[model samples]
Target: MDVSQVFDLNGKGAVEALALVEAALQEQRRDEEVKLWFKFDPPQPGGGETLFQPVGRRLRDAIKHGHAVRAMPAQGGGWIVRLAAKVR
Candidate 1:
């Protein structure tokens, strides 16, 4: 499944968005071939920043023990995280 369909942030607050991601990861565990990518849009300038770092850290930890994969931030403020696990 596409990452967008599996995870969404439509109008939902940040906390809920993080929760949704956690839940999806839990479910993906059943399938060994699942891969996940979480992309967060840059916060509006001057707007309070989202706690993406902490959340991202925790996510990294959670899947670290599993087959999940993750990506670190790139230059120019672009971040891409990919979680992949071997199926079968």
Candidate 2:
């Protein structure tokens, strides 16, 4: 499933972003999907990836469980993080 909601965490930091992802993941269940869209620091790809490192690790774990995530740069700054898990 695609994520229709884009969380505007413009002024938030990586910690906040990670927290949001964690919270979203918690509510997710098997056969369900959770795609998150949020902003993080640095704007550029390098900084964005570094800032999202921890979050990426978490998402990687989710991937092992049949989940997936993607990150893209936003127009203004930061990144849009998308997390998803498909129903098996």
TM-score of each: 0.59, 0.50
| Model 1 lDDT at residue 74 | 28
Model 1: per-residue Cα lDDT over 1-88, one tens digit each: 2342334344556678778767766666443344454545556688676546655765777667653576455232323445566466
Error of 1 at 76 (Å): 12
lDDT of 2 by residue, 45-67 (tens): 45434445665676667666645
Candidate 2 ranges with C-alpha deviation above 4 Å: 29-34, 41-50, 67-88
Per-candidate local distance difference test: 0.55, 0.57
Looking at model 1, the pairs that clash are 32-86, 69-84
lDDT for residue 75 in candidate 2, whole number 0-100:
49
